[model samples]
Target: MQNQTETYMRRALELAKRGAGHVSPNPMVGCVIVKDGRIIGEGWHEYCGGLHAERNALKNCTEDPAGADLYVTLEPCCHWGRTPPCTDAILEKRIGRVFVGCLDANPLVAGKGAQILRDAGIPVETGICEDECRRLNEVFFHYITNKTPYVVLKYAMTLDGKIAAYTGDSRWVTGEAARRHVHETRAQLSGIMVGVGTVLTDDPLLTCRIEGGRNPYRIICDSHARTPLDCQLIRTAHEIDTVIAVTEWNERAAALKKAGAHLVLCQAKNDKVDLTDLMHQLGAHGLDSILLEGGAELAFAALEAGIVHKVQAYIAPKLIGGAAAKTPLGGTGFAKMADAMPLKNVTVTPLGEDFLIEGVL
Candidate 1:
């Protein structure tokens, strides 16, 4: 049986996920207040520039919390930002003890919040469900510490490692269940990106159709401003946020901007948008995690740029082999086997008629 603190922390993790797609650049945090061996208050950080989980939880307490135990998914923020420091709220509430799932990776609060509580004579216990907490906030950790968004490259391919047939007939490559799973996964990230080739060929809406999942920002890497103005993404740009990264400002730029698509003029190197510069620009947009759902060229570009942190590939059982068939990855792949990218912590699971393979890059 788990201890009360561990159980409370696990519940906090569950609550934290509720803020997904809403809280970006900021980690999802959940808090629970326990009094008399019962949960009296619980809350989560719902959005940016909003009350943090600690303050939200404190606000919901009906009884005095002077001697109550507080369990939080991440360490309480100690520095001031859009809102007051969470540590101050904890002190104001007179929380006696705190159980933290993981230490925040943000330099502003890393180990400092816990120290503040300890100095106030409050008992602070750290590292309860730490791995779960780390995975939950890895995007925020990567963004804050590395100054870049966490990238997950996703694609669907047949058993013979072909993404599309010779005629480029890529529709319905995966089963309905796997497609639904992709939509659900997209709902959790901050944005989805595709190249001009994919936009021209697939014209995907890139919206999350799963229930209770918000649509993420849509990014199109159209170096020459070639994305059709009447495309589904541009047509619906006024409805959801869309970003077009281009190498040169052309006549079509005005139309795209007028269509409510944010234009990012990026310099091209070797006739390709600089992946490093694009990632930095995305960080400026407050995107902590992004899904790479583009064609093989984009996937290879991201992987070669060493920006891909994870890969989620859905493999169907069928084999669509052809000499002109498109593979899942392109570009100059590793010439030597030893130079290939390695994945760790790989997990394979069946999803309907497809198999989902997820691994850390």
Candidate 2:
């Protein structure tokens, strides 16, 4: 019975992921209604302001959900915001038992949803695959708990740690497989961040470029607002979302706005844009997560700011050794190996010829 419950909860988690890149500031939730050891209905959060998973599952069921068991990835929300309390729906549906993957980290519903069910005399069991469920909504949890955006630092470098050649030709550092995975990641996050230097040097479009995948909000961390009006991002700003983050507004910032870019001023420290301030601004603007695709300097600043939550480093098998070549991170690095930052929950994957190392910072 325990193994079967885990299997059902795993299915719920998979369904929850179907809402990836669509719901932000709201956790992805999936619900299943089961009766007599058979699945009756399954549903997941579809969008930001649409129906929630529990209510959708109750409404989608073919057979009678009354006196049946209900499983949900996250605790059903008990407060009224965009919709009424999900507890009301669960009670009305007459669910005999409830299985929850994890209690919500949201202060509003922390344990109230389960308490409500318990008060109504339904057996509610939580913490089924609890760790997996919590990690699945890390972005939403971080936003609710810290009121800041979760940042992931992503970069491609040679085996020798060089991000680019001596001439700064960084194109195709990783293989086609790794590039495809990057596009997939861009689709999952709410924002894709890069320094203005990356725009000027690579002239990258920064779009998802994958079929049926939506492009994230393109954010350029330009201290002086030096993003070119002719850049592809500026050209397509009207069609796709683009933001220019700057420390001070100038004529060039006005020109970029006139060219259809949205300009935001961030706090400055040490004569440069403060990455922490930039992250808070992004969070307040409704971006729950940011993928920091960088030009070494920005990556280092993000790390130094202590705002980077995850790292994705794609290491090519070939070596490009040169003192003049750029590495994944630059600026005043830690003076000693003992003072360097460490990662947890690290995993290494082989992407064609390149190796992708991912870890929590």
Give me the candidate number with maximum TM-score: 2
Candidate 1 local lDDT, 104-190, one digit each (tens)? 888888999999999999999999999999989878888899887899999999999988899999887899999998998788888
Candidate 1 ranges with C-alpha deviation above 4 Å: 1-4
Against the hidden reference, what TM-scores do the models get? 0.93, 0.96
Candidate RMSDs in Å, in order, are 2.1, 1.4
lDDT of 2 by residue, 194-300 (tens): 99999998887889978878799999999998888888999999999999988898999999999888888988988888888888888888888889998788899
Q: What is the lDDT of residue 186 in candidate 2?
A: 93
- Measured on C-alpha atoms, candidate 1 has an lDDT of 0.90
Enumerate residue pairs that collide in model 1: none
> How far is 75's C-alpha from truth in model 2 (Å)?
0.4
